[model samples]
Target: MRVSVILPAKNESEGLGRVLPLLRSVLPEAEIVVVDDGSTDDTAEVAAAAGARVLSSPYSMGNGAAIKRGARAANGELLVFMDADGQHNPADIPLLLARIEAGFDMVVGARGASGQASTGRGLANAFYNRLATWMTGHRVLDLTSGFRVVRADRFREFLHLLPNGFSYPTTSTMAFFRSAYPVAFVSVDVVKRIGNGSHIRPLRDGVRFLLIIFKIATLYSPLKLFAPAGLLFFLVGLGYYGFTYSTMGRFTNMSLLLLSASVIIFLIGLVSEQITALTYTRPDRP
Candidate 1:
């Protein structure tokens, strides 16, 4: 299969200087396209000097934006996306591609604990992995890893759902699962970034990542989130009603309100589930 490797870069001149040559050595025949996300530095120059096709953005759009642009420009049946900051290893490209050839529509590079840049980020990734596993009913080794290989056509199908920011990996992974595509994960070791510090802010990206929990439910299975919430409310309502009936010999207004709320929440969940199912149905299917 024809393969195109895409590297999304934002002021990553130093790392690209090292990574491009190494990447070329491993996949000499593959086309390397670098999307420079509005870098003021010499990122575009470095990529060009390394003999990579560089696509420049006028202003800093976001990581996902760069990815989308690169995907659009890549001319290959299979597309590989990796960080330009040197965190991902070029040798792992073959591993991911091998998995794809083995009938997997998408293959993700699952990073180990040592791969994480900091303890806080590691904990966050673990939480995301667990939550994704529960939501998809399949084990998710890494939900936030940027290194992955995917069939070009399959990846483009859900491009509209991808965010403009850093959460594209999470969105795409969940999307493939929801669409019933075959996805696989392979363990890989990651190294420290060679250039400047990471762009992700813990407090800011933390809230964004938390919102991904809600997206997981909406994308793969709405009932996973709504059902639990509804059940909790229902159980609390029942307990409160029981207490009121035993103490006052009558159902209080609070009890009536809680019971009504429980019903409303459950009904909402049911409706949401139906809508979710409809969205996933293929246009080609009857």
Candidate 2:
């Protein structure tokens, strides 16, 4: 299958200059698509000169938006996505492709400590991995790595489900996993950024990242994230109702209100699950 490499860049002109030449060497046969998200610098110009088909958004559309734009323009059976900030190795593309050919719908470039990120970011990433793995019942060693290879058709189905922001990975992984799509991880060395400053802040993006995970979990399979919680609420309400009935020999309205509210919340979760499915389900979905 033909491979397509999609790079998302925003004001990453300097970084992209160094990244493109190496990428060309590693993936000479693949189609290279770079989406420049309203970069004020020479990002688009540099990418075009380096042989990548450039697509520019009129304004800053965010990382996820750039990815989607590149994907739409890509023409290959397999899609390889990587950051243009030069944190990912182009050499790993072959390894990712090899795993994809082995029948996995997606091959994740799991980050390793060898050339990984900052200490604060590393700790947070580790925490995210643990929480995500527990939630999805699938080990998620690198919950936010930007480098990955996915089957194009499988990825296209979830295009509308994507948010035009940095939380794409969290949502994509959840969607594929919730749909029972096959996935595998390939270890990769994450290099430090090639530029002056990182766009993501450890404190800011990390919290947003966790919230994204919870949101995705809720949408994917509400039962997995909410059932236990709903059950706990219901039980507490049930206990209060029983105690009040036994003590007063009458059913208290407050107790009933709590019980009703608990059940309603669970019903809301169930309804949300159905709505989430519609985002990627077949045309004949219920």
Candidate 3:
């Protein structure tokens, strides 16, 4: 199979210098494409020097935008996406490829304890993994690892839904699960990034990751989220009504409100579940 290796870069000339060489050595037959996301430095030049086809954006779009551009330009049946910051080891490429060859629609590089940049990041990843697992009913080894191999055609289907930011990995991973595609994860150790600093802001990205919870609910199973919430309100209303009737021999407005809200929320969830199913269903082609 023709494979394309896509590296998304932004002011990552130094890291690219080291990463591109290793990729070339390990994946000699693969097409390497480096997307320079409006880097002020010589990132495009560095990638060109390392024999990688360069795709330069006029302005800084985002990491995910770069990925989309590279995917569009690549002429491969399979696509591999990895960081340009040297955190991903090129040697692990073969492992992901092997899993993909074994009939997996997507193969992710599952980061171990040693792979995280910090304790906080590790904890955050753990939370994401658990949330994804709960959402999909399948154990998620990693939720945000950038190193992954995906079938080109399958990956392209959700291009319009992908955000133009750092959370593309999260979006794509959840999407594959919702679509019922075969996915696998292989443990991999990550190295320290070569660059001076990371572009991700913890506070900002943390909030964004939190929003992924809603995406997970909407993507795979909206009822999983809405049902529990409705149930909570329903239970609370019932309890309050019982307590009030026993004490004051009266039905309170608060109890009625809660009960009404619970029913409304549940009905909305049922409608949403149906919509979600229709949205994801592939229409028959003539």
Off by over 4 Å in 1: none
How close is every model to the real structure, measured as TM-score? 0.96, 0.89, 0.96
Off by over 4 Å in 2: 113-116, 202-207, 241-254, 284-286
lDDT of candidate 2 over 1-286, digit per residue (tens): 8889999998888889999999989878889999999988899999999999999989998899888888888999999999898888898888988998898998899988665567777786787778778877889878777899999998987888788988788778777887778888999887778765777777777678668757757756776766776777788888988898889888888777778877887888788778777666786533
lDDT of 2 at 210: 68
User: How does candidate 2 score on lDDT?
Assistant: 0.84
**lDDT by residue for model 3 (104-135), tens:** 99999999988988899889889889988998
Model 3: lDDT of residue 1: 94
Q: Is candidate 1 or candidate 3 better by TM-score?
A: 1
User: What would the per-residue lDDT of candidate 1 be over residues 1-286, giving only the tens digit for each residue?
Assistant: 9999999999999999999999999999999999999999999999999999999999999999999999999999999999999989999899999999999999999999999989988998898899999888899999989999999999988888889899999999999998888999999999999888999988878788789878877888877787788788878888998998898888888877877887888888889988878876768843
Ranking by lDDT: 1, 3, 2
Query: What are the runs in model 3 whose C-alpha is more than 4 Å off?
Result: 284-286
2 versus 3: better lDDT goes to: 3
